[model samples]
Target: MNLPEILADLQLILEEYQSRLDHYSDQVFMLSPEIGCWSMAEVYSHVFGTCLMQQKAMEMCMQGQGMEGSAGLNEMGDKLFALGHFPPGKYEAPEALKSRVQNIHKEDAKALATKLLSRIKSVQSEDILNANEDQRMEHPRLGFLNASQWVHFMLIHTKHHLNQLDRIERKFSMC
Candidate 1:
C-alpha cells in the first residue's frame, strides 16, 4: 500500500486503541477476570511489546538498504492474513514477552500506548516504506517476514488483542 494510506490506517488504529484505554478507570485497567484473562492494561502492554519488536525489525531491514519480495509471498505469512485474524487458542508468549503485560499501572499504560503510536509514526516516511521488501526477520510463528509484513503484523496484532480487551471489559463488568 502507498505511504499515505498506510499511515492513515496506522493512525486510526493507534488512536482507537488509545482512546479506549484512556476511558477506563484504574480498577478496570488492571483487573483480570480470572487466572488466564488479561486486564486492559495488560493487553496494552503486550501489544506495545509486539509493536516495538516489529518496528525494530523494519528499521533494521530499511537500514540494510534492500527491497526484495512483497509480504504475502511467504506461505506462512500468507496463511496468517488468509485466516483474516489471529487464530483462536492460547499460545504461550515467550517468557521475556510475558512480563510485558504484568505489573502495569494505568499511567504506564498510557505512556506505552503513546510510545507505540510514536513508533508507528516513525516508520511513516516514504524512504522506510519504499525500503527493500526482501529483507526479513525471524517471526516466532510466521517464520521470516519482510518489513512491510512486519508493519502488517503490528496492525493485526493490536487488533487481535483489542478483541481480547473487549472480552475482558465485558467479563470484568459482570464481576
Candidate 2:
C-alpha cells in the first residue's frame, strides 16, 4: 500500500478512538463498566505498550538499527496471529507494564491517548515508505511482524479494543 493510504488509515483510527474516549471522559472511573474489565484507560495503555511501540520498532529497523528479536515469543505470537490472535507470551509484556496499567487513572488515560496519537502522527511520510512491509526486522520482545503488518496491528488492535470500550461506555447513561 502507498504511504498516504497507510498514514490516512492510521490517522482515521486515532481520531475515531479519541472521539469515542472523549464521550466517556465525563463518566466516573468506577462506573465505566469496563471497570474490572480492562477499562478504557487500560486499553489505551495496552495500545501503547503492545502496538504503538512495536510500530516505532519497525520504523527503527528501516533505519538500519533493527530491533532485538525473540524467536521464542515471536514464534508464539506469529502462531496466534495465524489463528487470528496475538499471544501474550512471557516477555510479551513485562510485569511492570501490567502494574502501570492497573494503576492508571482517568486523567492519565486522556493524557496517554493524546501522547499516542501525537507520536503516531509524528511518523514522517518518508519513513512510512522507507519502512516497507517487505523489510524484515527483529522485535525486542516477540520478533518479526513485517513492517506493514506491525502498523496494521496497531490500527486493527486499537480499533478492536476501542469497540470493546464503546460497549463498556454504552452501559452508562452519560448523555
Best by TM-score: 1
RMSD of 1: 3.2
User: lDDT of candidate 2 vs native?
Assistant: 0.60
| Candidate 2 deviant stretches above 4 angstroms | 1-3, 25-27, 30-36, 67-97, 132-143, 173-175
> 32-68 in candidate 1: lDDT tens per residue?
7788777777788787767887788878777773344
User: What TM-score goes with each of the models?
Assistant: 0.83, 0.67
Model 2 C-alpha lDDT per residue in residues 27-141, reported as the tens digit of each score: 4543436434665566666765565567666576566565444232366556655654343322234664566555356666667667777877877767666664545555444
**Residue 170, candidate 1: how far off, in angstroms?**
0.9
